[model samples]
Target: MGYAQVNGVRLYYEVSGSGRPLVLLHGGFGSTESFAALRPALLARRRLVAVDLPGHGRTADADRPLRYETMADDVAALVGQLDLGETDLLGYSLGGAVALRLAIQHPRLLRRLVLVSTPFRRRGWYPAVLAAMAAQDERTGERMRGTPAHETYARIAPRPQDWPRLWARSGELMRREYDWSAEVAALTVPTLLVFADADSIPVGHAAEFFGLLGGGHRDGGWDGADRPASRLAVLPGLTHYDILDAPALPAAVLPFLTHPVREPT
Candidate 1:
């Protein structure tokens, strides 16, 4: 566990196990602890570099707002600082957005990308989820007191008093408008899109996201030789909130990261 000075912010990250590195990013309001339950299986086969994104966990928020693009740049800088060369990148929720941007904006740094519960566009989230994000403000922190997100922040943040600010900034970032279909369609890195059957976004949107990666448009031939380089997995019996804790997360991830690409005969 250590800190890397990158993009004008001190980013905290923890490295565990041993093998090829897989940078793990957590959802908004979450920390490295977000994947605590899911890391064991992954650790056995791959090194886990779990990052505490800016304004989350040990890292404090900077003067700037918490925009996904800026956060992506921060992560890219962290990769450069660590000299990780080409490595796998995985992000959940907010971290997923950052991971998406980095893979699009700095593809050279990554060998593969895994995005869990991520939406390509803002409208990809259900209307109710959008309303919840839009409702967040400084006062939201008070309402969130004692909740897991709040409790974790209070326990580890450099300044627990900054919860309200973090809440507001995260809300602001989420509420902003965005659509990256063009960029997604242009992606070259092998990608995996994971979502729950009952995710924050519709299953159809998940299909849409996979489509952007050139998946699901055709049937995989016998032996799966006719599929796109990218893949999708919609795990059963889960939701956006609890998907991280599900063992199925690492279960779906390991094969994608470890399996070699097969060319059509």
Candidate 2:
């Protein structure tokens, strides 16, 4: 457990276990500790490098605005600094956005990727989810006071007083709009999109995103030959907030990351 100076932020990350490295990036308002439920399974299989993004977790915020592209660059810098060749990456929610950006901006850096409850486009989130997006402002931070995410931030953050700034900035970042449909279709890295059956994004968008990755388009022959390198997983009876903690999450994810996908010659 140490810090890597990446893109002007003292990025805090931890490495554990043995075997192929799998970098874990958490969702918004969360830190490396967010993976507590899923950690054992992931650590048992791969070298886990769980990191706290710029503002969340143990890492302190930089003077720059919170943006996925820069956050992705921070992760890229960390990966390069560690010299983790062809590593696997997994990100949830906000982390997923950063991971997706990293995969797009630096495809050669990843062998495989697992995106948990993430969307390629801002509209991918449900309308109600977008409603909550617009609802954020200065007062929004106080509204989050005493909540679990806020409480967690208050405990581990380098500057606990940054809680309000964190919330306001998170809202600002979430409010920014961009779409990567064309870029996603051009992505070469294998990815697994994991979404809860009852997620913040409409279930149909999952299929749409999967399709962009060249999945859900064709049938495998009798020998199961027509499958795409990328895959999709929808865990039952779970929502966006709880999907990462579900036992079935690793069940659906690990195999895709651990084994080789059969790419046709």
Candidate 3:
């Protein structure tokens, strides 16, 4: 692992395997270690560039709050600092939103995009999930102690005491309203949207998101010439919380990343 000074923060990242770069971003309150379960398979086929986002894991918190746009900018800068060109980028949950922002805001930086268990609109999430997100604060962080997330944070964070502060900032970011439907429709990347059959976002929203990507429309002809560059997969027997680590995650994504990019028709 090494640190890269970008966007006024020392970002920590780990590089493993060897081949085309595949940058992986973990979820909120999570470090690069969040992808441990998927690492073996991922590293086998491509170089894995895993990063710890601000206020989480080894990366220290900056003075600014955690907004997707800023975080995306940080990530885009990191890619430039690392000299990675048109790489495949995959992000889970909070990371997924960042990946989406990066793809939309820095379209030239990415070759293929995978957003796992992310919603284009805040309201796409279940009402209970939104309530829980809004309720997150320092107390929520304290309550999370003794859990796997806390254990990892305590082991890898620069200042473990900042855990509560991280939660507070994350909660603030989450509560803010955002609707990126129009932005999603305009994306030119060869994107893949992955979600659990049972997820925080309603299943209908998954189809709607795919539709916005020019998918789920008319059937492709026998030659499959009419298919959109974007794809969507709803993995079976998984939930938003666990799908990140599921073997199915890599199984579904590796093909998309390795295949030649399909230009938008």
Predicted candidate 3 versus true structure: per-residue lDDT over 1-265, tens digit per residue:
7999997999999999999999999998889988989999988899999999999899989999889999999999999999998899999989999999999999999989999999999999999999999999999999999999999999888899998999899999999999999999999999999999999988899999999999999998898788889999999999999998798998999888877656896
Tens-digit lDDT string for candidate 1 (1-265): 9999888899999989988899999999999999989888898998889999999999988888888898899999988887888999999999999999999889889889999999999999999999999988999977888998889999999999999888898888888999999999998899989999999999999999999888888888998878889899999999999999998998899999999854212
Q: lDDT of each model, Cα atoms only?
A: 0.91, 0.92, 0.93
lDDT of 2 by residue, 1-265 (tens): 9999987899999999999899999998999989999989888789999999998989999999999999999999999999888899999999999999999998889999999999999999999999798678668888889999988898999999888888789889989899999999998888999999999988899999999999888996787678888999998999999998999999998899878797523
Candidate 2: regions farther than 4 A off: none
TM-score each candidate.
0.97, 0.98, 0.98
Using alpha carbons, what is the TM-score of model 2?
A: 0.98
The clash count of every prediction, one per candidate, is 0, 0, 0
Residue 263 of model 1 has an lDDT of 24
In candidate 3, stretches whose alpha carbon ends up further than 4 angstroms from where it belongs are none
Task: Show the colliding residue pairs in model 2.
Answer: none
Worst 10 residues of 1 by lDDT: 256-265
**Candidate 1 C-alpha error for residue 120, in Å:** 0.5
